[model samples]
Structure formats: structure tokens, C-alpha cells
Target: MRRTGPTTVTPVKDTGPPGRGLLYGLGRACARHPWRVIGVWLLVLLAAVAADRAWGGSYADDFDLSGTPSRTGSDLLNAHGAAGSRGVAAQIVVRSDAGPLSAHRDTLTAAGQRLTALPDVISVAAPLDTAGAVTDDGRTGYYTVRFRENPAQFEKSYVGRVDAAVRALRADDVTVEYGGPLGQLARPAAADRASEAIGIGTAVLVLLLGFGSVAAAGFPLLTAVIGLLAGLSVLGLLASRYAFAAASPTLATMMGLGVGLDYSLFLVTRHRKLLHSAEGPVEATARTVATSGRAVLVAALTVTAALAGLFASGVDFIGMLGVAAGTTVLVGALAALTLTPALLGLAGRRIDRWHVRTPVDEPDDSGDIWHRWAATVRRRPWTFLLLGLLGLGVLGAPAAALRLGHVDAGASPVSYTERRAYDLVADGFGPGADGPLTVVVTLDKDHRTTGAQRDALARALRDALTATPGVAAATPPKATEDGALLVSTVTPDTGPQARATTALVHRLEDDVLPGVLSEEGATGYLTGTTAAQQDFRDILADRLPVVVGVVVAAAFVLLLAVFRSPLVALKAAVLNLLSITASFGVVVAVFQWGWGSRLFGIDETVPVESYVPMMMFAIVFGLSMDYEIFLLSRVRETWLETRDNHRSVAVGLAGTARVITCAALIMTSVFLAFLLSTSVVIKMLALGLGVSVVLDATVVRLLLVPAAMYLLDEANWWIPRWLDRLLPRLDPEGSRGRAESTGAAVPAGRVTR
Candidate 1:
């Protein structure tokens, strides 16, 4: 079936050869005990589900600032009874259309009484009880219901009870809305079942088209889902030990599902090809595991290590997110390694029995379309390289203008109680009322400081804060019970999400507070939800580069070890960075610049969520390695046989491009399907991940990488001889099998695959 080409293409000589050891043994052993392996996997899935229901932790956006100034200040105040230790509060903005809020006093009181009696609520302060809680219009006001435990600490049904308790406040003439963390908890749960169905459906369609067999299509989906569900359960347990963000699980799901399927797909693709060789099912399964499974393992390890490197950033939340996502990927790989072989064993030679059509013919020889494309590139490396660079440059240009900040509730969907609360609060008070800064000033416990000096400093601080450039108002300083601390509320002229608001926080902390407090031996800290979020943004942005450096270095070392070529490792790192830049640019354009933001349910333009870029970098970098390793493994495998880089690149591109393209399509579909999530944050993650996979698979893998290697020629595989000895070799393609493959060039009955 081999076609004559512009040039001859060298085959792998030894590919998926049964002589490959270790992984082959694992696969054969599992295949021989198919029922036992299947049973064990089933038990694992069951245990994971049961464990989550019994002892799983809660999910919330609990960004704990352990050593940050705001956290330190807040902790001191809470310890000294300056900050309310009454626990978390649900802020309710109330509006009356018929008359002033006074007209609805009885209803408000009843609502408060019911809330106070509700489970976990520690106290309730109705607007009428708290002076200044009502606005000047007298028609709008707010109240607080303090709960003993944070909302996530409660069961899901608890939200229903709170909803019922506040029903009286939502009459024809009155309305109630939830704000702050409470608002986050109050938002309706997004059902991802639809998205999951769509992803599976798309995967099935793609599998059928490629494999042309119904039975062959289902195993990948089944194993992926099994691994994913179990992995998710594990993440829930991790949430108990670590405070991961609310979006953590969704992010994990997105990664787990994509990788889980792709890993399984590779194994099954190899197994099916082996089966067609008329080899016994057990032998074919073993060879498939030895060959394709080794690639999956290396790819998985590389990804896990890269994600773990996120810890280098020194941000626990970011690092934990990486851990969360990495866990799923690890588990997914485990499933593929053990479970896929068992499934293959169960199916035997009948994998094609439930046929939809003959499987698509994939040409692995040098004369196929991808081979010709690679040949064309090899002949004109500069043109292909420049074209790829042009495309990537155009896509990534928007990243230069990325703006990172908190996404306020004002950006939440209108259907969310949080958004309604944000709007009502802004209208009733000022735009900044929803995110007031709490200035906590603590004087040293000295007689002079506690006396006239303390009074003088507090006065000066109040004067300076109110006169500050962005300040709209500042409340008079109120002393705590010990009189050791003074707390004041500072409102900015702009909303909490505005750049001006962040500038104001920095201005006060750096200049205004220091100027007054230093004279009195006092320390002033900006301690409030708004200020804490600003701290989060600043910390993450500052550490972005550290994370990038860690991930890139980790990848370079990994590639260098696997391929034993410094240039190959460096090319992969650079190409991965290009993929990330393009993806980040797309996210910036859609979410920050609002260039069709509405398509993703964003109502208005907003700053890119502060942590999004860092998270994206770590994830995209790891994922890009999957394909990088896949292609490079084959190229290296071929090079070891012939020591010819040009023929190896061409043959590798022709051989793997079909599977990689199909795999990219499947992964992209999974990521894109998550766009159905109501959370704007999740949608942003979906688009970024999806776009990255597409661009990386096409522009980078199909164009830039091959072109670069073509131009580099034999230099691509040259490693400094001294360093080569120091580097450990991890041949993902089984070197032992190469001796067996030399006899036939390629296994009989193997087509373009």
C-alpha cells in the first residue's frame, strides 16, 4: 500500500513491537486476568464515590492570605475584638417601591427574627437596628445575618432554608439580594451534566469517524469517565485538607476529562492496529501498552512535574489549583495504563465486530498527505517557518494589552443574586459602597501612644484619608473595646474593581498611613474584602514570571532527558511559550477587551481574572508537552535507527499527525463544551484551553516544530557529548522492540496509522 513519494520515507522499523518489555508484561498480565482487573477498577470507582459522599470537603473561593498585611491586620483586630468575630455575614440590600423602608419595618423585623432562628445564623442586625445602615433616600437599606460557619461549611440544603427565611422580604413592594461570599454561595448551582453529555457525544462522533467501529469507540469514553469521576472524588477530599478555590473542581474536570480520553485513545489506537496484524489479542494488547502506554506515562509525568513546579511561585492557592488539576491527570493516566488493557483483553479480536464502517485509512509511509506537507516544509523551511510565525504573531498580539484584576459581582450574570445585590447597593449608596476599605490602626501599647498621641494620630489619619485623591468619604475612627486599635471605613470614588480603587489602597498603605502612623509608633493596614482581593491580584501578578521560569525550566530538563538533545528541548520550550501567548491573547480579547464577550455570556468588559493567566500558563505548557513528546518520541525513535533527522521528522510527522489532529479535536471539544457553564470564570478557562490546544496542534505541531527541525537538520539531535552521559535516557519508544521491527519495516496489515 506504500505510495511513491517526492522522496523515500523511512519507517520506524520497530514500532509497537511485542518484544518491548515491562509495559508489555503489565498489559499481558492485565489482559490475561481481564475480569479481575475489571472488578478492581469497578471497586475503585465505587470506593471513590462512597468516600466523597461520606467525608469529602467543601468548595469555596477561600483565598487565605496567611502572611499578607491585610490578613495580619484582620487577625489582630479579630483577636482583640476590634474586628467582628461574629463570623461570616450575608449582606442583604433591601428596596421598597411603595414607600420608604420604614413602611416595611414589620416585615423586615419578621425576616430578621426568622433568619436568627435559622440553623448556623449567629445573629441578625436589621437595617432599623443599625444606625446609618439606611441610605439618605430612606427607600433603600441593608442588613446583615451573621452565620457561625462559612456558607461552604453548610450542606447544600441549607441554602434552601435561608431562601425560605428571607421570603417575606421579597414581596411585591420589597426586594432582597445577597452580597459578598454569601452572594457567591447564593448563586444557583450550574448543572454541567449537559456539558458532559455534549463532550461525550462529540467524542463518540469523532471516534466513530476515525475508528469506524462502535465497540472501539465506547471503551475510551467509559475509561475516561471512570477515571474522571474517581479523580474528582479525590479532589473533593483534597479540598478538606487545603483551601482550594471554588473553581478548582471545574478546572480539574476540564483537564481530567481531556487528558483521560486522549490517553485512552492513544492506547486503543495502538491496540486496534496491533489486533489487525492477526496477532493474538493478548500479544497485541501487550505491544500496544509497551509502545503507546510508555508515551502516555512520559507525557503524564512531564505534565505532573510541570504543574507541581507551580509551587515555585510561592502562592498556595495557585499551587493547590495545579495540584488539583495534576491529581486528576495522574489518576487518568493510571486508568489508561491498567484499565485499557483489560478492556482490550475482554474484546479480543472482535474489537471491530460492531462496525460502523471500515476504519479511516491513515498512511504512515512517507508519501501520505502529512508526509508530503512535511516534505514541502523540508524543501522550503523558511517559508513554512515564517508563515507559522505570522499566524502565531497575529493571534498573540492582543496579550500585550492584558489587564489583570478582580472580577467583581457587578460582572456577574443578572440572574445571580450577587449581581442584583451589587446593582442595588451601588444605586442606594455609592459605587464603592459594596467594597469599602477597612483601615485598621494599631498603636503600640505605650502610655504616650495610648493617650494624646493616639488621639492625634487617629485625627491625622482620618484627615489624610478623606483628602486622598481617590477617596469619596471616610468614616470617623472608632476605637475597639481595648482602645488599642482604631477602625475606619474608607470609600473610594470608583468601584472596587476599578484601577483607581487599587491605586487608592496602595496610596494609603504606602504614603498616607505611614506618614501619620510612623509618628505615633502605630501601624495602619488596609484590611477589608476589597483590599484583600487587591493583595491577591498583586501577589499573583508578581509571581507570574517565577512560575513561567519554573515551568519552562522543568520542561527543558524533561525534554532533554527524554530526547537527549538540547536543541530539541529548547525548541519545544519556545514553541510551547508561543502556544501560550496566542491562547492568552485570545482570552484577553474576549474577556478584557469585550471583543464579543457577550458570546460567552459576559455582559460587559472586565479585567482578566488575576490568577487566570498564571493558571493558563502552567496548564497550557503541560498540555503542549503531550503532543510535543508524542511527535518527538517517534522522531527520536526513527533517528536512533537511521541517524537521519530529515527522514525521521518527515516520517514522524506523516505517521503521528492523523492521531494528533484527531486527539486535538477531541480535547478541544471537551474544553469547549465547558463553555456551557454559567460561571464566566469557567467559560474563560474553557476558551483559553480550547484555543490553545487547537493552535498548538495545528500551527505548532504541524508547522513550526517540523519546520524548525527541518531547518536545524541533524543539529536538532546533537547533544554535547559530555552532558549526554550525565543525562539519563528515557526511551518512551521501547528500544528492545526495534530489533524485532527491523525484519518487516512495519507490521503487515498496518496502513497509514
Candidate 2:
């Protein structure tokens, strides 16, 4: 051992290996055959897109609630022909602003007849004929068009035909709106390309400013776009056989673009730095890939693993979404590991050929702002740590009150027909009219549930529902042909997304249903989109702990394996969770607490979409690890070299801070651009992701992480001897330093002071 100062001690060096690793070999090979690597990627992209176009299965939302009461009730309804004649209805809402809708009876009748004449139409209820279909004021009426299947399953053009079916009622005096999937089809389409362009545009600016070279900045964008397209193509192919949420591609695009930029940006930054002093492009590319590229690989793995853990939610729709995003992340890593080096090789020493300013890499440490920042944290560890905790605690406080459910159409942009329809229905018949819950009772086979007995049971159930504290109205129950089931709709006083609505659902399930039918030899359940959404919310809430535990444990293990330090791994997990908590609070504040909801085009407060937290946790957890690995890898390298905890922390933070900050800026910009989307769900995901990256990069990374590591000192690197021996020695940045110091894998020209 050697001592550099009174308190600084140096440990014996372990120089077990003197050869380049597989990452270097891959990078060297790709760099040596740049054209071939680029060509192969293009071919893969083309084949994936072509095959997906020809053979890919369409994406349909998988709301497969197998064991829930709502699912059972829904299944019974479908089996017994109670869900209209064939399937769920696509509604048409008609309101006469001029006067009572009685004046529009002739128009409504003609529209119903035309709708009834359309193919796949099982039945069309004329507002005048169906009881309670017209509002009390008679100013608003709706036509329920029951089809053989969900209209959402068909092409939007089909809805256009359905729209034509009601053209006669679209007069100046009549305010007509579509509901359900029909309304979704009727809304003006938002261009996903516009959002993508904005993200790419903003990312380019950050890269340009950081790299000071247009060509260098363009490389990351090129690699990222290629990876994103390839990933989306694969997602399309997966969608052919599996049911993915319709938003899967949108989510994929958002993540793929952001993380694709992330992986490529870091690789390019390291490559440029190495190429500046290295003898040849091949040597620089090899070293860059082995060092920073390893960080990218670990990051992608953490992200993919965290995403895979979404399966713990026990929902395929949610899990498949993870798959969709993970595929892009993995592909982006591939591009960084191979395509990035290839592009670097093609550029050679002229990587900054199209320079706006002389390219700048990491600065010498004497005046490094990051070093000053790290020292500041080290000197006042408690102050910085407490400051970080306070900021995160305040930001994350609202998440404690997080409520999960589906965002109703009432929260959508008014430009959407669904929103208009929701508003009109609420204004005419009360808020509950848009989210009516169907009450279903399955009569026991042992009992004679027929004639007066069945009628009496039905009446009792209906009466029970109508008299419930939250219910505004309840329709008379109608029996199926076999008389073994009875069904009715219950209208609650609150909107579907309201907390009161959630409470009402629970009250119905826990009290009214059992009280009315517990001894009547019947099983009752609330069924409908509203009830089903709430059921799904409960399922997610129950399984959230499973997902969080699995993802955290897996991440902890991965960090342990990579760093060979239990405390470091544990700290990473805890810190990542802190960042996620802050992000969750931001989401709850905006979407649930109604704080700045208008900025996202949301007209009303909506529950955090049931799966948003789950998805955000997986994504943020994975992504936060990227910065963790980037900073820690460099710190570990320094610790290995000098064996001084304080110096290593300062040098490591200084070395990597600029790159990490640039990457975070680009990623945050890419994600935030998606807030331009009118879809509330997309906006929620955007804000959560964008906010998480900012907090993680700034408050957590700059303040909390260094401060804690400084306070812990040598303990930060401690692990049980047995545990250390069991863990793999994976030193991504350390080996590069060793290789440079020994001149084993690089020329003398490649080694910089």
C-alpha cells in the first residue's frame, strides 16, 4: 500500500488481463467494415417494415379482465345476447339547441332507419321509442347503434360510412355528436410525425451545442432514428399475433426516439473524446465502445429488465407495452454498439468536419465546474442531501394521494367529438349519463327464477340500485330469453373519473348488490366500461407492489453484479426510486389534482390512468439507472486508480457530468415534445418521463448522489468478501484506464496524460 496524503491510501493494483474485451472486438470489426454494417442495418429495417406491412396482425386493446366480476358479467351478457343483438353499442348523441328535441323526432326517426339499414347493424334504438333515451327537457336524445362487433375493431373509414348513416340529422339546428369508439374515429387526427420532428429537432440543438459540430450531432440522430424505425417495425410484427394497446406504437416512438438518442449520444461523446488523441479511428472506436458503450449496454439491460418486470402486474396489455418500449431500447443499444462505431470510422479524424465551432470534449480538471460542484456537496453533505430530500419530498407528496382509473372523455380536448358528446350528455341528463353502470344478476339454476318470482327479484334489485346513496337513476331490469339473467343500467351522480364515482362503484359492489341479492339465490355485479375500468384500476393497485418489488430487486442484483458493491447497488435502487417518486407526484398534481391540467389540453381532472404509474415506474426506474451507471462507472474507474474515495468521487463526477447533462437535456426535450399530443394519456406519459429525467439529472445526481457517496466514503465500496467473490468483475471504465496505462491495447499516441 502507498499513501499520497495523511488520509489517502492506495491499494495494490490488480492487472489480471492485458487484452481488449468483446465490446472492443465488436466495435473494431464494425468500424473496419463501416459500409457493411450500415448496409446490414438498412436491410434489416427494410425487411422488418416490409414483412410487418404484409403479415403483421392489427393491434387491438387487450382489456382481458379474466377473473373480475365485470368480466364475468360481460361474458354472460355476450353469451346470452344481452349486449344488444351482437356486441357493445356505438352511440350517436343528438341535441337540439333551438328547442325541445320533439321537433327533431322526424329527423331522428329517419336516421335510425338508415342506421338500421347499414351492414353489421343488429339494432338501432329510436330515441322516441326507448324509455329514458330522451332527456327530461326533451332537448337531447341519443340513438344506440348496436353492431355485430366493436366498431373500434374496424377501420376508421367504416366509421365514416356509419357517420354518413346519420347525415340527415346533421342540420343547422341539431348538434350531433358521436360517442364511444365512433367518437374516437370522428376526432381530428393528430400527426405523430409532428411530435417526432419536434423531439428530433430539439435533441439536435442540444447535441450541436455540446459537440460543437453538426456532423457529430447528426450521427447520433441518424443512429437513433434508424433504431427507432426498426424497433417500431418489430413492434408492428408483434402486434400481428398479440394484442397491444393502440397506444403501444406511440409509446414506442416516444421511448425509442428518446433512448435511442440517449444511447447514441453517450457513445458519440466518448468516441469523439478518444478520437481526439488516439492514433487511429479503429483504436479509438474500440476503446470508446468498451468503456462508454458498456454503460449503454448496461443501461439498455436495466431498462429492458425493468420493462419485462411489468408482467408482475399480471396484465398482458401492460406487459406488452413494456416489450414494445424495450425492443426499441435494445435496438438502440445495438446501433450504439455497432452502427455508431461504424459511422465514427467513416468520419475518421473528420468527425467534426461540418463544424459550427471547434469540437470540445471533457475539459482538464483544474477549472472543472463539476469538480467544484462535487466538492461543494462533499464539504456540506448534510446540507445538499437534506436540500435534495426536501425538494423531492415536496414534489412527490401528491403521489401519496394518487388515485388510478381511466380518464373519461370529459377530460379530452373539446375539439374531440367524444368530449362534446360527454359534455352535452352531462348538461342534458346529468354527468352520470355518460358513464352508466350496468347491473347484472345471474339467477341460480337451483331456484325457479321465472314468472312473478324472476320479475320480483329484478324489481327488488332495480329498487335497491335506485335507492343507493350515489345512484341518480336505475332502469327496470329486463330478462334474457332463458330468464336466467337480469340486467339494468344504474346512473350515478358523479362523472366516471371522479373519486365519488369510484366510491359509488365500491359501495354498489360491497353493499347494495349483497344486501339486495345475498339470500335471493343470485349473483350480482356491476358491468360496463365505467365499472370495468374501475375493476382494472383495483387490479393494478393490488399488483403495483409486485411490479415495484420485482423491478427493484432485479435492478439491485444487476447493479451488484456490475459494480461488485452491495451498498452502491442498494443506493442506486433507492435513489432511482426517489426520482420516480418526484415524477409520480408531478403526474398526480397535473392529472389528478387538477394543477396545470389545461396545459396538457385536459379539460377536467382525471385519475392517473390505471397503468400510467406502472408504466412510468418501469420506464423511469430503467432510465434513471442510465445516469447511475454513467456516473458510477467513471467514479469506480477513478477509485480503482487512486484508491481515494473523495478524489475518485470528484474526478468521476467531473469527467461524466457534462455528457450526462447533455444526454438528459436531449432526452427530457424529446419526451416533453410529446405533450403536444391532445391525447391525455400520451401527455401524462410525456410529462412524467420528462420531469423524471430533469429531477434525476439535476437534484438527485448533482446534489443527493454525490453528497451521500461523500458521506459514506469507503463504505460505499464495501461488500461481503463472499458476495464480492460471487459477483462478476465488470469494470467498463476501469479496464480502459488500465489498457491506456499499460499500453497493452493502444498505441503510445492513444494514451493521453
Query: Per-prediction TM-score, please?
Result: 0.94, 0.93
lDDT (tens digit, per residue) of candidate 2 on 413-438: 78888889989989988999889998
Encode model 1's per-residue lDDT on 200-262: one tens digit a residue.
Answer: 889999989877877677888888999999999999888778788788888888889899998
Q: Can you give the lDDT of residue 633 in candidate 2?
A: 90
User: Candidate 1 overall Cα lDDT vs. reference?
Assistant: 0.83
For residue 618, model 2's alpha carbon misses the true position, in angstroms, by 0.7
Q: In candidate 2, which residue ranges exceed 4 Å CA deviation?
A: 1-18, 56-60, 83-85, 98-107, 171-173, 728-731, 734-753
lDDT of 1 at 688: 97
RMSD of 1: 4.9
Which residue pairs in model 1 clash with each other?
Answer: 362-752, 362-753, 363-752, 364-752
Report lDDT (CA) for all predictions.
Answer: 0.83, 0.84
Scored by lDDT, model 2 comes in at 0.84
